[model samples]
Target chain A: MSSQDYWKANLKLLSVLLFVWFIISFGFGIIFSEFLDQFSLGGFKLGFWFAQQGSIYGFVILIFVYVIAMHFLEKKIGIKEEENE
Target chain B: MSSQLLTYIFVGLSFATYIAIAIWSRASSTNEFYVAGKGVNPIANGMATAADWMSAASFISMAGLISFLGKDGAVYLMGWTGGYVLLALLLAPYLRKFGQYTVPDFIGTRYYSKTARLVAVLCLIFISFTYVAGQMRGVGIVFSRFLEVEIQVGVIIGMIVVFFYAVLGGMKGITYTQVAQYCVMIFAYLVPAIFISILITGNPIPQLGFGDTLVNSSTYLLDKLDQLSIDLGFSAYTENTKSNIDIFCITAALMFGTAGLPHVIVRFFTVPRVSDARKSAGYALVFIAFLYTTAPAVAAFSRVNFIESIQEKSYLDSPDWFKNWENIGLIAWQDKNDDGLINYSAGKPFEGSRPIFSDEFGSQGQREIKNLPTLDNSNEVYIDRDIMVLANPEIAKLPAWLWL
Candidate 1:
């Protein structure tokens, strides 16, 4: 694949990752906090859990997700820095 | 005659070590100055980043903030540490790949615009200076209490020390020095905590002690803190009084803001490889979590102690500890009803006695409290939240030498 194609795929993956970020933090944390709160998890109030601890856990997950996604993106693009001539 | 002198001698030696390190590690080139030639070890960088990030707030003020905030205080815990996620994943490697000396340099070069660089620099100066002013003030407050110097003199001394290292060695000197500082500060923080935790819970591990039932209390330590908080006209420790929407937006804003902070992102750039940047962040988080997890426990313990000790006392009978803080202008009680005693109600005023009433009173009553000024000279509310942390160790009935 050419550099142009690689950049295109990278951008697509980025958009999906950003959407997931929005869903966990803004969606579950705010919009669906009430829905989530119906189910108690350990010591935390669901909404408060999402707001405090849950969203944080989600963020760490998202980071790893991006890392794995980026690794695949690098492979797909054939432009991994380690392989550069 | 001996111990105090020994303290002075020990503190003086520490200061000398810092100065010597600053002088020795001074950087000549801009690259060396800004990123330490991008060759820092992952572990060293982690320690350095921890100190750089902890600042006076973490060392001196965070536990107090957590004590007062309770469960909502987790925002600081999650938001602050969660930022490392943003740093490690979103910003760190990309910025390192850009291979710049400063954050502004990365921005300026990436977009290929001088104007962008200039704007970035301007914003950097504004943000850094505003935050630095607060840190300097914190240093002054800490110094005044520990060193027994006047606050203004403390500020001057702090500025001189910071300026010598920050200006002379630039980023290189600051980086290595910060690693040393991380050791000093973490030791300072952990020593007191370890002692206090063992003293109170018969358990020295603060993290576990937080979850474990207190020695005398039936509930987990946090539940007791929550119960105590409600009894004292405050919100419960584990409860969320903030609207969910507000919490979500604020947390989101903070997460992004953490990722965007230039200083933190800049730390990642000092590592040799993109992989190193990723790993350094993991290390940084672990180092930071050492304090973050422990802080809430410290806060819970201190709040319980502070209230239990002082809740029933009359204003005239308020402990020597309370009076000491009042002398520093950190705590005050206005005798709203001319009552000799200060109550939890004294801190919170109703409709009329609020700021509007106070504004009117200052203009009308030549008869305000004599020793304490109602406001700082700037006419702002005078309660300094930072004082809560400083007062905690003392309020816990820790020894006088603990301040050192």
Candidate 2:
């Protein structure tokens, strides 16, 4: 991929992941919590679960996902760190 | 051995370990001091980052805050952790690419202004001192409670111990010492949690245990907690109390603040490669999530345990932990209406009537609520939320090892 294409792809990936990040932490966890609370996950209210633990789990997974994605992207774009270093 | 003696031994051992690491890894040059010669393993750096990020507040006060705040506390839970996403995605790799020693150095060079660098330095100093003040206070509180020393003496001991390690090792020493600290702190945090999880919900993992049914009851733990909260006139544990806007603002502020913290950002720069920096952030979040996820469970468990153990009990009949905390001024009780039973309710006990105790009494002072000639004496008990986490193992009657 061209350098510009690589940058664009990276931005797109970031936006998609960040959007997920917003929905999990702020959307489901906060704004729609009462609505989500109507459902139960295991013994926790779904909303409460999202707010307390679900969001945090989501964040951890999100970062690792981003890391893996970037690694793949770097290879695909021929921007490998070893080459640059 | 007595818990106090055990505390002394454990604390002494940990201090020795930190000092030993400092001596062993003492920086030979400024580069080693600043960035560990930029040779740290990503995972090790991640653990050190976790230790640096999860300060005394996360270890001691977070669950306590969540216990009292309930749903309102999710702001902290999400805010603190979610920032890692921003850091990992937006800042870490790029900053690693830039490869600067300090945040101010990056700001100075990137902005291409000496003025910007000076401003960054000033801000860094201000923020760091404020954080250090909190950590010092936390150290003192822990020492005073566990070591049974005066707060000032505790502060002095903490300063001396810190001075030895910090002066001896610098960043290289701190990196490895912090890795050890991460292990010790995480173990300290999780052991009690695992024990309490099993005791309360029969689930070994606190994260899952929080959602499991209470061991003796058919009802879900959260369901039972919600009922208990209502019984005590507090909001349901699952109920959201703060305005959505307030929660949003607070969460946003905390998330951004976590990302913007100079010390944390600097941790990313210490890794060998930009790719490693990305991986390190992931690992840091993973380590952090262990405590972050478990803290809410601890909060819920402690809140329910605290209410069940103390509420409506006669002041004279209060548990030893309650009295212990009271002696430390973290808990206080007054028999409002001259009834020996303590009335622990949600909100300020004296909202409508003039408080028998002056507001000037502050946090630590004991206010005599007796013989208030002017107002109806309805206010009864005052408990600082901080005591909840420290005294939790005791309140739940966990084994002595978990208490330490």
Candidate 3:
């Protein structure tokens, strides 16, 4: 892939991941928290759990996913900063 | 051993270990001083990042803050950790790839203007000083409460130790010592959480135990806490009563703000490769999540125990833990109805949260706090929310030294 293709692929990965981030943190934790709280997980209501606990767990997992995805992308396309001569 | 003695020995030992690490890792070159010679292992850098990012507020006060805020506390949890995601993916690797030592340097070259670099430096200075000032106060609280030293003496002691390592080791020194700090700090944070979780819910893991049913009872811990809160005229524990917008703004600010801290960004440069920088952030969040996940559990457990122990209990007959924290002034009982029993109800017990102390003592031998009570609720007790986590050992009757 050309450097531009590599950049485009990188943006796509980021967009998908950040969208998931927004849904979990903002969508579930805040906007729809009360609606979602109708369900329960273990001792916590679903929304409250996401607010205090689950969103945090989701964030950690998401970062690792980014790391793995990016590592593979780097290998396949090699966007590792090149020196211009 | 006594709690005081344990604090002395453990605190002394940790300081000595930090100083030793600083000496051993002294920067041999300019590169080492700036970013550990840009050769740090990814995992070690990640651990050090966790230690550096958490701050005194995270260590000493976060659990207490979450306990008080209840559902509202998620703003902090999400904001801080989510900020890391932004940092690793969008910011850190790019900064590392540029091979710059600090944010100002990166801005200076990228923007091709010294003015932009100066602006970055100014912002960094402003943010760092305020952050450090709050941190010193937290250090003071731990020293005064745990070690029985004056807050001033404690702060100076803290500064001297920090100065020694920071000056001597540079970034390499700070990095290694910080890794050691991550171990000690997390151990301290987790032990009390585990103890309290098991004591209340019969589960050893605080994360799961937070959602587990209370020991020998069918009700969930969160459900029990919610009921206990309402029965005492306070809001339900699991309810998110704050406006959704308020929560969103705070969480967004924190998430983006996490990537903004220049100090944290510097950690990315410490690693060898751009990929290493990204993986290092993932690792940092794992260590951070260990504490963040447990905080709400600590919050709920401590809230349940706090309300149960103090609500409607007469002042003189109250547990030693209640009086011990009260004596430190983080807790107070104002009997507006002339009743001797404690009732921690909704709303601030005083006009502002601060209590004005008179020289006179109450009938129950509690200090006479003459602050005009707010007439909003029939509540007759003033309990500072910060005491919940620190006093959890005493509340649960767990033997001391668990935290130390």
Top candidate when judged by DockQ against the true structure = 2
Point out where model 3 deviates above 4 Å.
A78-85, B149-153
For B1-404, candidate 2 gives per-residue lDDT tens digits of 68778877988899999989999999999888888888888899989999998977788788999999899999999999999999999999998898789988998999999999999999999988988887887777787787677668878887887877888897889999999999999998899999999999999999999999999889998889988888777788888888999999999999998998888888887788899999999999999999999999999999889888988787667788877766665566655566667777765554434333443332223344332332443446667666677899999999787778
Give me the TM-scores of chain B across the candidates.
Answer: 0.87, 0.92, 0.96
Tell me how much of the true interface, by contacts, candidate 1 captures.
Answer: 0.19
Model 3 is docked with a DockQ of 0.60
Q: Cα miss at B94, model 2 (Å)?
A: 0.6
In order, what DockQ does each candidate have?
A: 0.24, 0.70, 0.60
| Candidate number achieving the greatest TM-score relative to the actual structure | 3
lDDT order, best first, reads 3, 2, 1
Which residues of candidate 1, in runs, are more than 4 Å off?
A: A1-85, B1-3, B314-318, B334-342, B349-383, B400-403
- Please rank every candidate by DockQ, starting with the best: 2, 3, 1
Count steric clashes of candidate 1. Answer: 0
Off by over 4 Å in 2: A82-85, B349-379
Give per-model CA RMSD.
Answer: 5.7, 3.5, 2.1
lDDT of 2 at B335: 56
Docking quality tier of model 1: acceptable
The digit string of per-residue lDDT tens for model 3 on A15-38 reads: 999999999999999999999999
Which candidate, 1 or 3, has the higher TM-score? 3
Candidate 1 global TM-score: 0.81
| Per-residue lDDT over B217-302 for candidate 3, one digit per residue giving the tens place of the 0 to 100 score | 99898888888888877688788768999999999998998889888899988888888889999999999999889888888888
